[model samples]
Target: MSDQATLEVRNLQTHFFTKAGVVKAVDDVSFSVGKGKILGLVGESGSGKTVTGFSILGLVDEPGRVVGGEILYRGENLVGASQERMRQLRGNNIAMIFQDPMMTLNPVLRIDTQMIEAIKAHQKVSDDEARQRCRDALGQVGIPAPEERLKSYPHQFSGGMRQRVAIAIALLNKPELIVADEPTTALDVTIQGQILYEVQKLCAETGTAMIWITHDLSVVAGLADEVAVMYAGRVVESGEVDGVLDAPQHPYTAGLIGSVPSRNARGKRLQQIPGMTPSLLNLPVGCAFKTRCSYSTPVCEAAPVLSEVAGGRQVRCHHPLATEAV
Candidate 1:
């Protein structure tokens, strides 16, 4: 990872207003993605990882909005950018890959048509030039016989191939940043690994920063340069991937890593976190993970702000586990 930060999210708070109550989906979450680096935004379902990605892309719909904090791309703040400006930015300098391929691909249009239109939408390129770029993008994503694949519609491709097409479309503009929300979750292991390798290669080659949002820790272990572990709408711990995984200081982070099957002793039952994630609308007053944590004390009733710990990691816990103990 380089010293240059491509995207920085500072104290972001995205909330949903409902008749029941206000839901702070992404509360005070913060992280930065360096150029050509992949930052894994890890959390289980409803932990607000997806919402965070949507907020950055300005794709949050009605009843939900980015209420606070700064979303700085390069050096400019995008939190209050006008719709026109956001539109100009999206798919040009920034792109998003949804968990489902269908979200990025149109069932009715041929692959070449969609890709060509995507390139032309961002740049004033000729049809031939756009087509060549589209073909090259498809090849970059490991799609075989890109020329023939371009003529096929979305349904003609398999699940893995369709995802490759989606990724190709996202790369069409050579975006500086890409927010991929579990794009490979549904694919077979082999295909997923292939896609991950291609994506890493692409980022390195193009200097594209990426936020890979996923609940899978193993995926992050292999793919990310840095990791931010989220629980109940807040980052519980964050640091370099190896440091966080090998010596997680936060109880929540340790619980998550311990739960991964590969970390367990051979032929032994996998460890599991003690409790369910707290509801964002009605979270506990203290540390959100206190109930699940073994080291919880009365002091945990007051939320702990993220603090720098050993090994340059950050943890938000009153009773952080020692690195050696973990």
Candidate 2:
């Protein structure tokens, strides 16, 4: 990892102010992504992984906002940045590939029109040059007959095809940082592999930093340089991908690994983590995962702060699991 990171998120707290109560969507979450590296944000749905990505890009809507913390992009804080400033930075310095392709695609606009507009918005490129770049991007993402596809509208494409276009668009400008929220979940295995390879190549060649948010551990194991496992709006554990995945310290992380198909015997039922995630509005007294974790102790009644354990891994647990669990 580089000493000077491309992005550093420190003590981030994004909360939703609802009529019933304030929901802490992302609480005290922190991580960093070095240039030319990928950080996997892995967590179940509603674990605040997606919200964390949105918080980074300044995309959190009203009633939900980054209440605290510093989102430092090369040392520049993004919290409370002007809308105009964020607009100028987006699609150039920073780009986000949302979970929904429609968030990136316009139903009425031709693919080429939207792609060309995106390029011209941040750079001084001629329409012809921009159009060619658009065609090349589509081709790079495994889209066939790029020239013909460019003429088509978003609604004309299948869900998976439209997602490919959305991924293509995110790569068009070659932003320094990309926040992708499960961009490949909709793709078939063959297409997903191609996208993964291309993304790895893009970062390696262009020094791009990325935060790939997904619930799939298999994807993270192969693609990410580092991984942060989140639970109940907080990162419960984080470290190099191999170290964490092979012998997870946090019980939540261990449970997640145990539940994967490859970890269990054939014909046997899958291992399950006990209980459901606690509601953010009515969180327990201390550690959020305590209710579900088998390693919980009296110390867990008071929140266990994320601290470095052996092998330089960080685990938020009063009693972390042993290697025997593997």
Candidate 3:
């Protein structure tokens, strides 16, 4: 990993102030992404992974706001940056690829119009040049007949095609950072593989840092160099891919690995992490996973800090699995 990382998030706390209660979506989360590296944010739904992404991109709206955090982009603080500055930074220096392609593309406009507009929005380029760049980007993502596709509207393309366009739009800027939130969930295995390959190539060629948020360990196993597993609005463990996947330290991490069908022990039923994640608004005392952790101990009554173990891995638990003890 590079010593000078592209992005660093320290003590992030995002909360939504609702009439019911204050929902702590992302509670004191911290991680970093190095240049040209893909960091996988793996967690179940409502684990605050997507919220953390939005928080980094400054997309969280009122009612839900990033209350405390230091979002450092290449040593600059993004948390205190002005809205205008952020607007200029987003989609130009740092881009985000949302799960839904339609969210970024307007159905009323043709592909060329939308793509060209995005290019011209940040650069002093002519419409023709922008159009050419758009075509190149489309081709980069393995979109066939890019020239023809540029003339078509959103409704004219398939689900996978639209996602390709979205991915293309994200790559158009050759951004320094990209946060992709499960952009391939709807795609079939083959198409997903193609997209993943394209994304990897884009990052390798441009040295772009990426945070790929997904619930699929298989996806991370193939694409990410580092992995962070989150539960109950906090990262339970994070480290190099092989270390975390092969010998997970935290029980939550172990349970997640066990739940994967392909990882099940031969002739044995698949293991699952019992109980759902607790409500953020009404979290239990001590370690959030204590209730569900089979290895829980009296020390779990107090919240555990993320302790650095071997291989630079970090695990937040009073008593980690003996198999991975440092």
TM-scores for all predictions: 0.96, 0.95, 0.96
- In order of listing, the candidates' clash counts read 0, 0, 0
lDDT of 3 by residue, 35-108 (tens): 99999999999999999999888989889988897999988888868998888889888988988765657889
**lDDT on C-alpha atoms for all candidate structures:** 0.91, 0.90, 0.89
lDDT (Cα, tens digit) per residue for candidate 2, span 124-231? 998889999999999988899999999999988977788889878888998889999998887777777877898898899989999999999999999999999999
By summed lDDT, which 10 consecutive residues of candidate 3 come out lowest? 317-326
Worst 10 residues of 2 by lDDT: 98-107
What TM-score does candidate 2 reach?
Answer: 0.95
Per residue, candidate 1 scores C-alpha lDDT tens digits across 35-115 of 999999998899999999999999998799999999999888999999988998899999999898755688888988999
Query: What ranking emerges by lDDT with the best candidate at the front?
Result: 1, 2, 3
Worst 10 residues of 1 by lDDT: 255-264
Question: What value does the lDDT take at residue 135 in candidate 3?
Answer: 93
Q: Name model 2 segments beyond 4 Å from true.
A: 1-3, 323-325
- In candidate 1, how many Å is residue 108 off? 1.5
Better of 2 and 3 by lDDT: 2
What ranges in model 1 sit over 4 Å off?
1-3
Best by TM-score: 1
